[model samples]
Target: MKKTLSLVAILAAGTSQAAGFQVDTHSARATGAGGAATAWLEDSSSIYYNVANMVGVKKLDITLGDTGILPSITFQRPNMEAEGQRTTLSPPPHLFVVYKPFEKAAFGVGVFTPYGARSRWEEGFSGRFRGYESSLATYYINPSFAYELHPRFRFGAGLDIARATIELTRGLDFVNSEGSVHLGGADWGSGFNIGVQAKLLDNLDMGLHYRSAIDIAFQGQADFQNIPVEFQSRLTDQKAHADVVLPSTVTAGLAYRPLNNLLLAFDASWVDWSTFSELAIRFENPSIDNPLPKRWRAKWKYSLGGEYGVTDALQVRLGFTYDPSPSPNNTLTPDLPDANRFKVSVGAGYQFKPFRADLGYQFVALADKESTAPGMPGTYSGNAHVLGLTLGFNLQ
Candidate 1:
């Protein structure tokens, strides 16, 4: 069981749908606006969006937020009347704090889960050869600083310390038998983020942000359970090692306020998922080393969102987003099933004295995808619900 869990983690890390499972929903306000915050951020959560905007924050502020992802994934194969498999949900949480003791300089610290999710398939499912169960998670601890270059422009940078964990389980080829392998590991890596924000006009602002890629080397032990008598000795109690790269991304956005009580924002983002070209696992036994191909390509996403001030202390929000898949048909497996998708969201915010709170919800629908891979023929469909909450407090 231990080995099955560990192996599942490494393999599952390679299969993600949201910008390659990068987790774009960080702040409830930004999520409610369909992830268009770049220049429209006002709370300390700006630490995760555009670091340059940190200088625009008011006094000292801190925010705590969480996003829950509930996904329903199903698969159907040729000539099979059996029911589809369903997946489990994973939650991502975040915390951020920002302070500006000087007129032109600001600093912040944050802890957040930027990438993670899990998938599980039914026993004896048609796609058992590809994957049975897996889970992957990543967390980042960031320390950031920003400077107001001028009255209208700001620049910022941050250091990212990241930690990742994985567990995976999959079936093995055996005659009329139930045999599986488990793998698990954990590691830490480093990366960086940079951004620039400018007030283009009195009521218009523009921003650009970039997050660098992180490489992690996961080392752990693998266990072969219920293996046939012939394969048991060679596969059990072996050491495992895998090197993986988390992709990089760039985003640009604009925020415009035509009326004092209304704000609009739009964003375009590009992710370089080609970095995740393959997954190679090396065992203590050199003869067992193998590589898994992952020919993912770069992809783009667009979002638009709006907020209206309904009263002095209340605001309403709405947003929409379009995300295209990067995985190709030939390499598409049940483990990492994916396709183009759309997201619609709604949220509201209210302020009570020195504290402000916001809640947002999003509905995700993925386009159906079919595969004709030689012996593996199947169709995958999925939908998800995302809910986010953010709480902010002003100390100064």
Candidate 2:
């Protein structure tokens, strides 16, 4: 029973791997530019990257988009190898609306998925005892307000409302064969975000954005199945609860335009993942409570992107990003295998009067990592392909 409860803790803790689960493809324009749209302006997605930049929108703007992520992950140990199945086609969609009520103030709302993950391993994999199937999804709704504090500066803040769901399934060693345990839960959380944008020079702009951490309390049930009649009474189904903290992040960016037809942008971000050092799960049966330790570290991410205007209504963009993993080897788990990654992206956009359409594609390559964590020791390798599309309409 203790071991079964421990798997629950691992599932909850593993879901917070921002480096592996974070969804950065909020906008096709930004995704194509390697998610480097902090200071650059021209779209309603500003409500997400840097709300202060909402001042760049016209009288009224509406943007809608979605990104499809397909990931391939594999694990190997000695002579045995296993592949993770493709679980989802698209996690969620993004929608942003910005309205300028007056010349100096702008109000906007953004709906998007910031964190999500889904993975499934083969039926007879060696690590099935730890975890074989897992999924986590979070949705965020932000209503923001921006004000022009100065002719060249603007500031904004938003209220963040989030909802999250988690599910995990793993096998239980019962001496002869294996029984399975499935746990599912859902919860709600709240946080805040703030940002500032400034025109530093005639052709240069700078922006900074911050998103606060959110604590969620999940309550659900755990179900055990296929257990032997002898142990069925001891491993009965019961309710479970866990509290998790989503990390905070800060990003700073700069955009430079050297020519009328070219725009370049760079962004750096810091994630405070150290908050997830430990986790505790309380069950309906107090005797089976379990506590787990996960000493994750903070990480930094950097990106660079450029866009060139090819014609009056056409633009092309290219971008690159370097993201490092925060999870140390000692705490790594099979549920979420993470590693440093490099991402390259390309995109194009065309405008026809009040309507604009953008298409972006990104390829993620994860560096192979060897893990020697306690009982599970193996080599993990994976990569992902992401495609995004966004449409914008200027109502004014």
Candidate 3:
């Protein structure tokens, strides 16, 4: 039982879906203009976007910011259906510091909601057979430093001290009983992050970053109340154990400004979902047909955004992104409810001396995807929509 719960949490795929466990945490000033801040990062937000850029400074700098993700989901199929619904507010906030304690070098530290998110469904959703209710959350604090080998080459590294929690529930076998069974519990782990940025030419810049995967091996207790009395008594151990393998990923991209005040950026990233197979747990031995038999494949996602300086203090940004699904239809699980997605975003920012404000909006359309397990009766279709907001400020 413990193993099953742990698998559910580690395998809870959608926890950070902008890219597996990635939400692009940064200042709205950066995101407001579609991450064009790569080369133009003359602000304190550089602590997260690109620490090396802090070399632009001559004074002490500080930044504080926050963003929100509001997602809506829906389920449909020949045999089952549910109304579209929106998730609760996922508020992510960040703080950054850059101290030019010495010339040609910058020292910094920050606390932010770097990676994590969760989803929830009503008790009677159609895909209950695969997963009923799901919940996950994570927080990170990083103490970092960076140096400028020269005006064009900058590098940075940091340790990610993270805390996470997971909760899961799935429908029980009707032939077996009533209501859904809780299949997961909360657990925590830690990891690291390393990244670099380069200015090869006057108008071109590149960035590379890597995030290590964290394994949440959880231990807990569980029991099945709906099962027949005989089976319940025989399974009295109640101890649960599971090893959840999340994957490490890499991202590389470029930023270019075509016109005097127009900036362009493109980023391509890889997420290794292949690490997930059948989320197995052990009793005396592993169950042949664990309610969820998932096989997610590795995939890549890319984004292109542009920023235009409307005026010295205000700028407008717009962009589009396409992401392929990691899970095949046959292996999809309600817990992950993932699909290929298309997103469109627009935002603007205004800077007034030492203060700045950013506002943005986005719309996401999900492809119609399905999931069907052999013993799980029928197939189900899935879909969803999402909108987000970002706000930021920097001061000396």
Candidate 4:
């Protein structure tokens, strides 16, 4: 029973749609710019990237956006190869509103998906016992306020209310017979974020933002099927609980305008993945209690993006990012075959009076990873295509 229940740890340590499963597609403008708009205060998305920038809002601004992610992954071992079977698109949405009631103060709210991922493997795959299908979704609702302290400096803080859901399916080993187990759960958590934005020079701006970690207590059920009659009594369905701590992050960015028509931005982020060193699960049946070690390490991500005004109402953008995986090779598993990633993106935006629209596309490529973890030994390779669209309106 312990062996069979060990696989459940993957539910909390699953594959990430983005770097370690953190989603950065809050706005099409930022996405097209490779997510480097931390200091480029041009849209309401500032409520997510750097709330301090909200002080720049002239009056009232609202932005709505969505991103679709399509992934293709493959795993190979010796003479056998299996293709990931997930075919559906994962779409995460974002909405932000900023209102400036006075010259020095602004209020804003944002709703977005900051972390989520989905993975599916073909039937009869060698790693089915590890994890066949899994999905995780997290939502963050933030309400923030910003104030201009100095003429060129602004500071802000926000409260983060988060909700998360998880579901997973894995095959159960019975030697000669095949069985399966499914787990599902939901939980709520809270955290906080603070940011500072400063205008260093007429053409340069700097911003720093920090988000605290959140702890979620999940309570759910585990259902088992096809258990042999001999072991049915021991492996029956039961309740389960787990404690998971989401990582915190600190990001710094600079936006520079070298040319009157061109704006360039760069950002660096440090993720405290070390906080997820282990996961402890307590089942209704004490016999199945499990503690899994993750040993994930902290990592850094870098992004560079540029936008050029093609005309008074049209703009073109391009961006690039390098994100390293936090999961170490020793503990890597089939459920989340994490690896370093490189991304390239391009987009365009148009402004029409009180309405604006932006479209962006990005391609993510993961470096092939060779894993020798216990029963699953293979080389995993994958890539994803992401497309995003955003619409904005200004009410004065």
- The Cα error of candidate 4 at residue 185, in Å, is 0.9
Give candidate 2 misplaced runs (Cα > 4 Å). Answer: 1-18
Compared with the true structure, what per-residue lDDT tens digits does model 1 show for residues 130-186? 677878888999999999999999999999999988887878778778788787888
Question: Candidate 4: deviation at residue 78, Å?
Answer: 3.1
User: Worst ten-residue run, lDDT, model 2?
Assistant: 1-10
Whole-model Cα lDDT of every candidate shown, in order: 0.80, 0.79, 0.61, 0.83
* TM-scores, one per candidate: 0.94, 0.94, 0.84, 0.95
lDDT of 2 by residue, 132-170 (tens): 787777889999999999989999999999998888887
Sort the predicted structures by lDDT, highest score first: 4, 1, 2, 3
Is candidate 3 or 4 superior in lDDT?
A: 4
Worst lDDT 10-window in candidate 3 = 377-386
Model 4 has an lDDT value of 0.83
Candidate 3 has an lDDT of 0.61
lDDT of 4 by residue, 220-309 (tens): 899999999998888889998777777799999999999999999999999887766654557788886656556778899999999999
Q: What is the lDDT of residue 92 in candidate 2?
A: 57
Q: In terms of TM-score, how similar is model 3 to the real structure?
A: 0.84
